[model samples]
Target: MYKATYFAAALSLALFQSPAVATADEITILAGDLPPMFNADGSGREAEIISTVMERCGHTVSFEIQPFTRHWKTYASGTGDAVATVPVGMPLGGHQSDVYIQYQNGVSFLTDAGNTYGDLAALAGHSVIAFMGASDILPGLKDAASSFKSYKEVADQIGQSRMIFGKRVDAVVGDGMIFAEYNRQLREQSGDLMFDPNQGVTFQAIFEPSSYGMNFRDAQLAEDFNRCFAEADAEGAIEAINSAWAERYRETLGTQYLGH
Candidate 1:
């Protein structure tokens, strides 16, 4: 009986201390469509940076789309391993990296008439539409835009471009790089598309840059990413990827926000 008992205890110990099975190595990322930053299709500047950084850290990363309103809910429910470009004032219950991306939110207009309104206060009497989450990420822009004759919120950046071109609204507010891309895509999509006659759009930077961070559920994984990011960042890999995009939108991004 003593020998049998000892053998059972030894077996249990062996099982407990045995090499753990290797599961699929992947980190699931969740985010909404916030163009030039986070895209549902996984091609934004931040998305590119995160994937490159995470992969360099020896892990495969995948992205899942959720609207801004529902992305956090899904992340909190333990659906995603990490969240990219987390907005301000959102709950930071888990580990998060340093500010990975700083968005210089700005106002964009299609026609010269739309440019007349220099500041947010001056936009009170105009019809305006802006990207969703602007209210949270850009409170001042949202508040000032609220006093407009009519204010609307949209999910996709393309919608903003459509509204501006159709004369549906006087101005649109969003990131400079995104607005430029939206216009280009619309123009490309408009070949034999519609009878829209509008041109010369630009985004005016009026608000302070808002910072967003990469939040992770696993503390160790977060730390790991942070370390890898530091090395990649030191080599200017992130900035190198963004410089061309930033340079492309220099005029619309304003003279103040391009120092990075």
Candidate 2:
């Protein structure tokens, strides 16, 4: 009878301590504040994708949004459990997950400028402006800058649109979506930026797509993310999130957004 009682207690303890009853972990993710992709309030498409995938993996998620370059520094200093939007093969230490997002970087010039960039080489001898640290972040950009008439990088991406609209530069180089978002803001709130937002702009896909992923401090978390992300993607949830954001841009920026 005592043996039976011992077995019952052991079974109860095992049941109580089972993985099925384990509480979900909350993971804090650090990301860049690139709107329409990643926002400070954790409401952007990338944020939604991360939240959805992590939730599917039975984990709660939070975000700490910083500047595009600063987030890498924040991650390096061990500030968060994970960092998103990290380019593949970046030197940051951690278990990197599969490439889950892509940023389409390109060169934008006035559609009326009669400008056509078949490739990065075509950008030669043109005054160009790009996001801060772009030369370092973008492959071959440093070498390409040497041939441009003039090249500069700005921390505030809104300046990319303003500089191009104000005729301060021949072109702006960055993500098409980010540039579109800035243009949308300029159209709504020109303020002191004296430039014609109505002017047609052309985005030339001269560079390769920027593939990004997440890095997790825990290898198990990275594996779990990969599994859950694949599962969510198979269910079409990931594509739905992407399409919803693209539709928002389409409504705001017209059919020109995303080559649509």
Best by lDDT: 2
Candidate 1 per-residue lDDT over residues 1-260, each given as its tens digit:
00122123332332222222223478888886655666668777778888888898898988887765456555555567787766543453467687667766667776466256557897888898877656655657646765899988777778778788778888887666777777777877735645373477766677667677776777777787889888998999988877766776665554534453
Question: TM-score for every candidate vs. truth?
Answer: 0.78, 0.81
Which window of 10 residues has the lowest lDDT sum in candidate 2? 1-10
For model 2, what is the alpha-carbon lDDT of residue 182? Answer: 83
How many steric overlaps are in each model, in order? 0, 0
TM-score of 1: 0.78
What's the alpha carbon RMSD for model 2?
13.0
- Candidate 2 colliding pairs, count: 0
Candidate 1 residue pairs in clash (backbone atoms < 3 Å) = none
By TM-score, the best candidate is 2
